[model samples]
Target: MDPWLTLAVVAGMVLAGTLLLNAIGARVKAEPLIAIVRAGLQLAALVVILKLVFTSMWLVLGWLFVMIVVAIVTSTKRIGWSREVLAAAGTAISVSAIVTVGVIVVTGITGRDPQHLLAIGGILIGNVMSITSVTAKRLREHLQESRDEIEGMLALGATPRQAAARFRGLSVSHALIPTIDSTSTTGLVTLPGAFVGALFAGSDPMDAGLFQLVVLGSILFGGAIAGTVLTQLLGAPKVLPQPPREAEEETAES
Candidate 1:
C-alpha cells in the first residue's frame, strides 16, 4: 500500500472515530470525549509506528515487544497498580499472546510468513491488549464493588474464591459480550472489516468466510482465556480486604 494512502486512511479513521464518540456520548449522556481522544491518539500513533515497523524485520519484532510493554503497563495502571494486579495482568497478556500466536505458527496455520508477520502481529496484539485491559479493569472494579457481599459470604464460611463467585463470573462474562456479539453477527448484523477487505482484495466468498471465521474463533477463545483467567487471579479470595468486625456490624445495625 502507498504511504500516502495509509496516511489518508488514518486520517479518515480519526475523523470517523471522533464523530462516533460524540454521537455515543450524546445518546448516553456520558462524557467520554477525553477518553476517546486519548484512545484515538494512541491508535494513530500505533499506525504511524506500524508503518515504520513494516520496513524491516528487526523493527517489526521490536515493535511487537513495544506493543506488549505498552499493553502491560497500561493494563496495570488501569487496574489500579498493586503487586497482585500487575502480576495478574502481565500473566494474562503474556499467556494469551503466546497462545494465539504460537498456535498460528506452530500448526503452520499462518505458516510463520515473514511477508505478513507485521499485519498478523498487529491484529493479534491489538485484540490481546484489549482483552487484557478490559478484563483487568472489570475484575478490579467488580471486586471492589462486591467487597461487602464477598465478605459476608466469607463470614458464612464460604472459601475466599467462593465468596467472589458471582461477581467474578458475572463481570468476566460481561467483558466477553462485545467479542461474542461481533462473532455472532459477523455477516448479517455487521460485516466485519476483515471479511469485507478480503472480498475487496478479490478473495472468494468462501475463502473470506473461512479466514474471518478462524480469526473470530481464535479471538473468542483467546479473549475468554484472557478475561476469565485474569478475573479469577485478581478476584481470588485473598485480594478481598478484611474489614473490621465492629465496622461491619455498625453498618448492619444501621
Candidate 2:
C-alpha cells in the first residue's frame, strides 16, 4: 500500500472511532485522540530506530529495554507507581517474556532475526503490562470494597494473606478473562493479528496458524503469570493496609 494512503486510512479510522465514542457518551474523554496520535508518532520513531538497531544483538537488547521501560511507565499510570507494584509488574512481565521468547528461540519456532525477536518481545511485554495493570487495579478496588470482610477475617485470626486470598484470586481471574476469551474464540470469532499479518507476508496457511498459536499461547502464559504475581504482591498486608476502627467509625458518622 502507498504510505500516504495507509496514513489516510488510519487517520480516517481513528476519527470515526473518536466520533463514535463521543456519540456513545464514553467517559474516555480525549484519550482515544491522544492515543491515536501518540501511537502514530511512536510507531514512526520505532520504524526508524528498528531499522538502525535490527542488525546488532546489543542494540536489539537496548531497544527491548526501552520498550520495557515504556511499558512500566504506561502501566504505572493505571496501577499506582508504588515500589511493590512496580517490582511485581516488572518482574512478572520480564520473567514471562524471557521464558516464552526463550522457548520459541530454543525450539526453532521463530528465527533469530532481531526484528522478529523485537516484534514478539514487544507483543509479550505489552500483553503482560495490560494484565498486570488490570490485576493491580482490580485487586485494589476489590480490597477496598471488601474491607469489612477482610477486617472480619483478620479479627478472626486470619493473616492478611489469608484474608485477601479470595479477592486476589478474583482479580487474577478477571485479569486473565480477555486472554481466555480470545483463546477460546480464536478461529470462530477472531482472526488474530499475528495470523493475519503472517498471511499478508505470504506465509502458508499452516505456517501462519502455527505462528498465531505460538503468539496466543505466549500471551496466555505471560498474562497469567503477570496477573498472578501482581495480585499476590498486592495482597501483602503492607500493600493493602487496613483502616483503623476509629477512622472507620468516624467516617461512618460523617
Candidate 3:
C-alpha cells in the first residue's frame, strides 16, 4: 500500500467514525479524530526515539524510567493527588513493575536485549498504572458511599482495615475484571497489540504466541499486585474519600 493512500484511508475512517458518533448523538465526535491524529504524531516521534533507545542500554533504562514516572503521575492525577495518594500510587506501580520485570529478567526469558526489556517493562508499567488507578478510585468511591456503615463498624470497635475490608476486596476485583476477561478471551475476542506487533515484526507464530502469553501473564500479575497494594494503602482513611474537585481544593488548602 502507498504511504499516502494509507494515510488517506486512516483519516477517512476516523472521519467516518466521528460523523457516525455525531449522527447517533453520542458524546464522542471530535475526540476520535483528535485521538487518531495524536496517535500518529506520537508514533512518529516514538519511532525516532526507539531507534536511539535500541542502540544504548542506558537509553533503554532512561526511557523506562520516563515511562514509570509518567505512569505514576498519570495515576495520581486520576485518583486525586495528596501526599498519601502520590506515595501509594508511586509505590504500587513501581513495586509491581519491578517485581514483574525482575522475574522475567532473572529467568532469562527476554534475554540480553535492552529493547525487549524496555518493551515488556513499559507494557507492565502501563497496565499496572491503570489497575492501580482503578483500584484506588473504586475503593475511595465505595468507602465514601458506605461511610455510615463504615463508621458504624468503627464505632463497634472494628479497626479501620477491618471496616473497609469488604470494599477493598470489591475494589480489587472490580479493577481486575477487564484484565481477567481479556485474558480469558484473548484469541477469540481480541488480538492483543503485543502479539500482533510481534507477528508484524516477523517473529515466528509460535514465538509470538509465547510472547503474548508472557505479556498477558505479566499484566495480570502486575495488575493484581498494584491493585492490592494501592487499596491496602488507601482503603482505610481516617476520613471518607472526597470527590476529585473537593480533594483538589483540600490539597490546595493544605
Question: For candidate 3, which ten residues in a row score worst on lDDT?
Answer: 238-247
Residue-wise lDDT of candidate 3 within 1-254, one digit each (tens)?
69899999999999999999999999895999999999899889989999889999899989888899999999999988889999999999999988999999899876559868987998899889999989998898898778889989999999999999999999999999999999999999999999999999999999899889999999999998898888889888887766667778999999
* Candidate 1 deviant stretches above 4 angstroms: 1-59, 237-254
lDDT for 152 in candidate 3 is 96
lDDT tens digits, residues 140-163, model 2?
Answer: 878877888888888899899999
lDDT of 1 at 147: 78
- The predicted structure with the larger TM-score, 1 or 3, is 3
Q: Please tell me which model should have the higher lDDT, number 1 or number 2.
A: 2
TM-score of each: 0.72, 0.88, 0.88
After superposing candidate 2 on the true structure, give the runs of residues whose Cα lies further than 4 Å from its correct spot: 239-254
How well does candidate 1 match the true structure in TM-score terms?
A: 0.72
Give lDDT: candidate 3, residue 109: 74
Please report, in order, the local distance difference test score of every candidate based on alpha carbons.
Answer: 0.73, 0.82, 0.90
lDDT of 1 by residue, 1-254 (tens): 79688767876676667678677774533334455557668888977876776678888777777777777788788767888778888888778877876777677664354434555556666676687777666665676666788778888999988887777777768788888888888878988876787789898998787777767867877777778778778777575543456458878999
Better of 1 and 3 by lDDT: 3
